[model samples]
Target: MSQTVDRALSILPLLAQGPADLGQVAERLGVHKSTALRLLRTLHEHGLVYRQQDQRYRLGARLFALAQEAVENLDVREIAHPHLVELNQNCGHTVHLAVYEENEVLYIDKVESRYPVRMYSRIGKPVAITVAAVAKLLLADLSEAERRSVADKLDYPMYTPRSTPGAAAFLKELAAVREQGWATDLGGHEESINCVGAPIRGADGRVVAAMSVSAPNVVVTAEELLTLLPLVRRTADTISREYSGSNRPKKV
Candidate 1:
């Protein structure tokens, strides 16, 4: 990286905890006051950082503008939101949209269950890398070698009585998921809470993410979930159309 860019980038974390003065930034970065000043000036000029008369520095509006652009560029959540709401209303169950990120499943969006009894999971929560129906969908997207490697390295904790136990079991379940294009958590992650998930394939034929509908086991049977399979897949396909990956080259 260029010296100026690297110097400017190094100060971003400090700005995250609110703002900082020149001396404090210089001290944290282990640079002379003059060097820090020069870097800050350049950053301010480029709108990457901002400075106040109180001598404190924080991230600038340019960064926020860039963040807005990035968010606008991401169409997955936009497309999924309406479908998820519909799914929730129709099934009277909670619905979630989860994407793969750094080996974990990140909940990007979700809808609450309409039923009186239900399990609750939050958006932005990072679930375990090895478990969960949505996580399994991500694993299905990996190449065989990558899948094996990830399975080998994972902790594979037992979240509940029905949770898959080891790498071998996980592999078997993943195979089923690939074959069926869906996965199930039969009260796996949390006993008595069942979930059914289907992979959302991009135009590239890659599994981009998974959408799930979850509810109390007693109220929603696996058979009932299976009955809703076609709707769930349709919803996923509709949203995948708006996903960025849909524009990429597909496998078939």
Candidate 2:
């Protein structure tokens, strides 16, 4: 990319943090005041940045409108199906894509397990939110207060002896999920099933969805399933980039 375009693009994120004066923008970009002014002027004319009477600039309405429009048109399942399929093929296990809706985590897509012993789940089914790996990832994205509220109201059914027993344990699990950027379920929802999952983030870096791979303990031990976590995360990242319309490749 050209230096001019790069510098101009850099100004958007700066303004997004809050309005900034000419000197601040110049310093942040490591460019001279006049060069910064030129970039800001171009952005202002394009309605991506707006100048206030205080001589500071912030993001413009046009940017928000464009963002909302793009989000409304994004069909996450359409963008993610192929990646989920690829993950399923690589792991030879059941793969799932899920989103939080109406206060429930719903499986939006799934690929059947290649083995004869398939998981008893289908697309559009509400996940076992209290203990499912994909559900943990989706719920972990909620605010602390929101997580607390949800944990308080949920029924802690011991789907197995390993299922979340109460709000405190569930909240702790969510906190760990938040810190780790991924989650797992080992005989939590079912005594014989295991799952590993990663979050799919949007351009703003918020979790928009999650994907997981699952198999029966008879097919693969928990330790073996975890070895696929890196692959699961990579697949999720690929889907996130396509869904967010980001062309930049992941750096090592």
> What TM-score would every model get versus the actual structure?
0.70, 0.68
Pairs that collide, model 2: none
In candidate 2, which residue ranges exceed 4 Å CA deviation?
1-74, 246-252
Q: Candidate 2, residue 139: CA error in Å?
A: 0.6
lDDT of 2 by residue, 1-252 (tens): 799999999999888899999999999999999999999999999899998998899999898788657544548878898898988888899999899865699887889999999889976668999999999999999988889888898888999999999989999999999999999999999999999999998877878899999999999999999999999999999999997785332542
Off by over 4 Å in 1: 1-73, 242-252
Q: What value of lDDT does candidate 1 attain over all alpha carbons?
A: 0.81
Clash pairs of candidate 1?
Answer: 204-250
lDDT tens digits, residue span 1-252, model 1: 697777778998778778999998899988998999988888889898888788789989898788667645556777678888988888888898888866677887888887788676776668755668889988988889888888888887788867889999998888888888888787778888777788877777788779888877678777887788788888887777766444665445
What TM-score would candidate 2 get against the native? 0.68
